[model samples]
Target chain A: MTMTNDAQAVLPPVPGLEDDDPPQLTPAQKKRATSRHLAFQGGTAGKLLGYFGMLAAVLLFFVPLYFIVVTSLKTHGDIYSNPISWLPNPFAPENYSYVINEVRFDKYLRNSVIITGILTVVEVSLGVMTAYGLSFLRFPGRNLLFLLVIASLMVPNQITVISNYALVASWGWRNTFQGIIVPLAAVAFGTFLMRNHFLSLPKEIMEAAELDGTGFFRTLFRVVLPMSWPTLVAFTLITVVNEWNQYLWPFLMSDTDAVAPLPIGLTQLQDNEGLTNWGPVMAGTVLTTVPMLIVFLILQKQMIKGLTAGAVKG
Target chain B: MATVEYQQASRIYDPSRPPAVNRVSLTVADGEFLVLVGPSGSGKSTAMRMLAGLEPIDEGTVLIDDVDVSELRARDRDVAMVFQSYALYPNMTARQNMAFALQNAKMPKAEITQQVERAAAMLELEVLLDKKPSQMSGGQRQRVAMGRSIVRNPKVFCMDEPLSNLDAKLRVSTRAQIGSLQRELGVTTVYVTHDQTEAMTMGDRVAVLREGVLQQVDEPTHLYEHPGNTFVAGFIGSPAMTLIDGATVSSDGRALLGPDHGLDMDLPREYAEKTPGQVIVGVRPENWEIVGHGAAPEDGGASMPLTVRLVEKLGGEAFLHCRAQETEGMTASVRGSQLVLRLDHGFKGIEPDTTIHVRPKPRTSVFFHPENEINLEYL
Candidate 1:
């Protein structure tokens, strides 16, 4: 077949916006045109507002923290003269030393360490086992049992303090580590968190492990635990913080400096100094707060995920 | 390694509702690939899980090697299952996932490595051995799941819709790969799927189930050619067999086609004698042929006088979607008088609104009683 130009038809002129080169415009006109497109297209103004908003939130949290740091460094004279000063007039690192000696801070630190350490380990382990059994195993009254666990969350710690104290006194556990740590570990929050995390796990993977000839404990430790490090870390961080800062239960239980955790020990400074010795009190507060702050900072990501894992479905 | 059997196995998930898997008895021979196929909620997966000892068999026994395994735990039963989700351990690498079962069994490290390596090589997953399941594609993850089961070397392999997770193209290719892989391993396998094509293509023998009841267990050719009932006949084929109900046989052996008396056809004496009242006549799409147009009956042969409502012309064949002019004799066979006729692609220039006379071949037609819908073939 021969090609022919006769087949080609003349093209009709098209209307509307056919110009390849943009029209020349004044700077003001260009500004108007560009601003119209930018206004609805994630305008720079909105992004600037977001950055400023975040900065405001950071400063809001940082101001009180800076005051605590300054107050902890201040001497008695400087603290009273201008209470809200940006910097301490005279630095007295010796206040921490005084508080440590007067409050028997060494014993208290040891007590806090032991109490928090045992509390975290027992709570996390029990939480994991309980969560695993509740999530994976099917038995009669499983959901009812889980509901009972969730129901425990509704019971405030204050209401049970007297009864728990009476029970501990009856067991001759007063001024003992068991009284303090055991009562704290009995809370259901950790189990609830860990159970929700386990519930979100794919059911088939657990079945696969069973068919692979893995026993219950082996599956829990090897398969479930390894995959759940985030939620584990999250629960551990929260538990450590809660155990370290525990006050009323330990205060009511521990009568001696040897058994009291940091929160109760910090109170000794208040009881002795009668509010005049704010320096040592703040210093003790800082000491108790710093270690948990470090833990929270390190595991902040997993902690948030663990805490919120209940609210979000997998 | 062993033959597996379900002797009247049943599972009731909730007491109020019907049993998920009703009493079902089936035997899968050693090294045989048996596929349990049904629609969703049809208890196919429940039956497979019962055999694997994952689901508790409520009222019957599941046996392996002629030993009742009903009371055994899933781990103690020594069976492995590839789940539909391809549930590879997310934290473990592909090699570790495949070797996990062996490790849990306390196999020697060298033996575990050897088995994993062999299975991985069979799956061609050498380069992906170190990759986590999250890092791999769906098909690759599926292979890793298969490799995990293969490393265990269990007595039976229970696969539940393993290919359902893959895309269409990948599903076809992976389906063939799993079929060949099962043949090579020769382990007694019980597979579950809702798709008829997968059941047909993959199984040595396919067991069709409906509403937790076993319909038939037969080879693919037998199931296709000789379904046991209306449900199996309608479900076994792609386009499905068109069943016209309420047809009556005259004393002269001429079977009336429709309730509207639209067409009449001759039936063999054996079938006509067995089916005296209202009967169901099943005709596959390909079996129907266009004989003549705009004419009444000459000799009494079953024919459908229909108007071509639509024409689907593929490159190699055409399906004439016709609608019966009258409503009376039309059964629920091909969706309310909309019958489809598959013809040669060479038949061109056919358009809608044209009339055609279609009849099923004599030997190919099957009859079922209208009330019970059971096959009349035994008579």
Candidate 2:
């Protein structure tokens, strides 16, 4: 009886406060107001301090990018100069053109585009379906299978290199797109991400569809798939970035210049010229990350939502 | 619309454990509105899900229009359901959500459009058809759910506490809307809710379930006036009916009158015959006519002594909480009217320890067998 009374006592005060005369802000609210005032007020010095802090953080990130851009713009003589100035004077457009027209940079760019594009498409589509199959569909050993896939998360790419090479040699798929592209497909992280994404959807939604006479695949396709776009886009961006800058896997798989992507091509140039063709090397690096940055800006909304959805569940 | 008959339909989740819904046999006539009412984990949801083909039936047959639906897949079964959560497709617009079934069936684009428009108009969602589920309010999303089901025009409409998610005021109005809409469509509908008010007001017949068993199924008035057991007796009414343990005072296969028992009445032979050991008496609040002070015991309208423990004065009628000295543990609700004798006013005037005496409404009084807990209604 006292338990009920205590529960009742906890509830009635809320109603009492609601029904009370216009509330005067208490000391707690005053403290909150004072803290907010300190952050916002204290005149010009506070505003300047806030701006300075932001500027310092921005400079910390921007310095490396500035160094890369300046190195790309300088000539070989300018790069080897005793003192490195913050700015590059007498900038040369020849470095960009030389990397573009003379160094077979176009082939590397084209190869990178094809490999990344094909690999991303494979990874996202297959990952989503695999996730859907494992998450939504019920089969035998589903828990064990998911655990196995999660187990794969801990296995580094190095562990698979020898076994994958043996398989590639047996298939005679070396220097082939299949060898390069297929190995990167069915990534475990993508599968796990989409599975977790599907898991986060309200179970009531599935029950509702079931009661509405929707089939298992229908529910997955109509309800589950449509809501999974944010995850798909995030997975796509991640795979693109991974496949875009790939060096070791591509280098091991493809031997000829025909299939060598930008990373390998730039490494080859570094080996050949050593310190002389630093201009074109820096230029290629700049070119590599520019498209990634551009793509990120376009789909940043979906990426952020997908990333945060796992943490903030329904 | 169709009649649904569940013949020994039992939903046993774990074979070792008891069924969630055990051996439920009931028939819902075509176009009859039936509401299944029970608390959480009472298997009302399990029963609705069984009817919806969301839960598998373990032991019996569910017949829709005399065709067994136990083997049928949910899509082929064609039973539309509106969920409590309103499970609208979050990504699609309201129109698309409503038209999803038709699209899945490979209907023509024009036909799908026409059906979507019709459903949107019927559900009053024409203005909001372009909005996604996230953009719509609770009520609008509920209407969209209704639209999705209405487009299918299934044989029966099963709703699992559809209005439980709405605000109080919206729940009241939506309850009326759903009731009228169910009648208008003339579909055999099975609605589930824990609220007796909803069960009483919206259902043509209300079925009360408890803990995986069907307690009673009857018309609202009949169920209210007559319950099958003590469970139904207490669960059906508000300000729950209080029971005086028959073991405490009953004697010689008969109910003993308290010292202030004004209305001297004998128990009917059925209760006295079966329940000599212990009997549970059931009475609603409105049954009692509050007696005035110093009322004679043997008068035509027999009166018992009572202390007005608490008074709640409503505009037309009021509730008087009276306590009997014989059983200090119990409280009785007496009607508030102009009594022959006046009572004290003001909250400060009433004493917490004061007593009251009142007679039960013997004509409407019911006695239940304490062993089986079955109410023995006098013929």
Maximum-TM-score candidate: 1
lDDT of model 2, residue B138: 88
**Candidate 2: deviation at residue B165, Å?**
1.4
> Tens-digit lDDT track for model 2 on A49-73?
9999999999999998888899889
Candidate 2 chain B: 10-residue stretch with minimal lDDT: B333-342
Question: Candidate 1's residue-wise lDDT over B1-379, tens digit each?
Answer: 9999889889999889888888899999999999999999999999999888888999889999999999999999889899998877777789989988898889999999999999999999999999877678888988989999999999999999998888999999998999999999999999999999999999999999999999999999988988889999999987778877677776666567544454554456677667656678788889887777667446655466788889887767778888876645544344356777788743476678987777776578777877788888754
**Model 1 lDDT tens row, A156-183:** 8899988988998899988888878877
TM-scores of the candidates, chain A only: 0.81, 0.80
lDDT of each: 0.83, 0.77
Candidate 2's residue-wise lDDT over B245-329, tens digit each? 4432245444544423334434665566676444566667676654444444434564446666566554344456665443332
B109 in model 2: Cα distance from truth in Å? 4.0
TM-scores of the candidates are 0.87, 0.86
Docking class of 1: acceptable
Off by over 4 Å in 1: A1-56, A100-102, A137-145, A170-172, A301-314, B14-17, B258-266, B292-303, B327-335
Question: Residue pairs in steric clash, candidate 2?
Answer: B305-B357, B306-B356, B306-B357, B307-B355, B307-B356
Clashing pairs in 1: B259-B329, B265-B301, B265-B302, B266-B300
